[model samples]
Target chain A: MVIATETFRPLVLAQAKARKLEPHLIVVKHPVGGLNAEELKERIDAAFEGLKVEMKG
Target chain B: MRIVNPTYGIAPQGEGSATAGPVDWMNDPIVLFSNNKPNAKELLLGVRDRLSSIRRVDNVDYIAKGSASQPAPPEMLNEVVRKYRIALLALGD
Candidate 1:
């Protein structure tokens, strides 16, 4: 699993391309620096449901 | 089914956009992103750890996108998505 902030998404996406690697990602709110661990976990956890759905496709 | 978070920028514009969509991982490979940020890594790792408990994902590959000089390479993205069934893009600001 991979996580990225909004601003860094382009960078992340580009890097993923350079190596030709495709991995699941969980995009959390930017400035994660502010969120406490628990809060960040919650955000990261939320992205999983979407992955779960995508997996079904 | 598709889920989009309208809160953040939905799509990139002007020399930085790609037509990424959902995929069926059961049939194809998956790739994750690492932007080289400590907090971003932590966040992605958190998701990776959580994913193990719910389902069995064989493996995930990490890729680099940009640096101080250039934006994400569009060609790289196009090539990466060509083989996969789905690409997960997270947007938060």
Candidate 2:
């Protein structure tokens, strides 16, 4: 389910813009497990259309 | 200047703990930030998905926290700036 809101979008977007960075790589981590740096890096290169399938199942 | 939504990560930290560690970058640029509090995985993942599709940023950094959290370590933020060179740091809630 898409949970992004108008308020959060601008904040996140503005952060990226200020940094002069490109929006491509996505890092996913749990509070306890930390992050699987390798897996997260892989997601960045994964196609957007396939992300849901890969992430969910 | 462009607006882009990028993926971020949430990792846990102890009280007074410093530094999140070295980040492994994808074939894209990254901006590392910190997130304090718990149960932030779903929210962060959703944000990442939304931002990755944008044509602006190549990556995002999200630091996670536990129930009782502390501010991000200055060294960590400094490392991010030193490593990435350009970054937008969001600390606390």
The per-residue C-alpha lDDT of model 2 at residue B71 equals 59
Task: After the best TM-score superposition of candidate 2, give how far the Cα of residue B8 lies from its true spot, in angstroms.
Answer: 41
Which 10-residue window of candidate 1 chain B scores lowest in summed lDDT?
Answer: B10-19
Chain B TM-scores of the candidates: 0.52, 0.42
Stretches > 4 Å off in candidate 2: A1-57, B1-28, B56-58, B65-68, B85-93
Candidate 2 chain B — worst ten consecutive residues by lDDT sum? Answer: B84-93
The global C-alpha lDDT for each of the candidates, from Candidate 1 onward, is 0.58, 0.41
Whole-model alpha-carbon lDDT for candidate 2: 0.41
Instruction: Compute the DockQ of candidate 2.
Output: 0.08
Residue-by-residue lDDT tens digits, candidate 2, B1-93: 976558655444432422333333233345534354222353445446665655344456554433236655777767666666333222222
For model 1, how does the per-residue alpha-carbon lDDT over B1-93 read when each residue is reduced to its tens digit? 888877765343443434446444554565555444445556656656766786555655445565423556888688666755544433333
What's the C-alpha lDDT at position A8 in model 1? 65
Q: Please report how far candidate 2 places residue A44 from its true position, in Å.
A: 18
Q: Model 1: residues >4 Å from true position, as ranges?
A: A1-31, B1-22, B35-38, B68-70
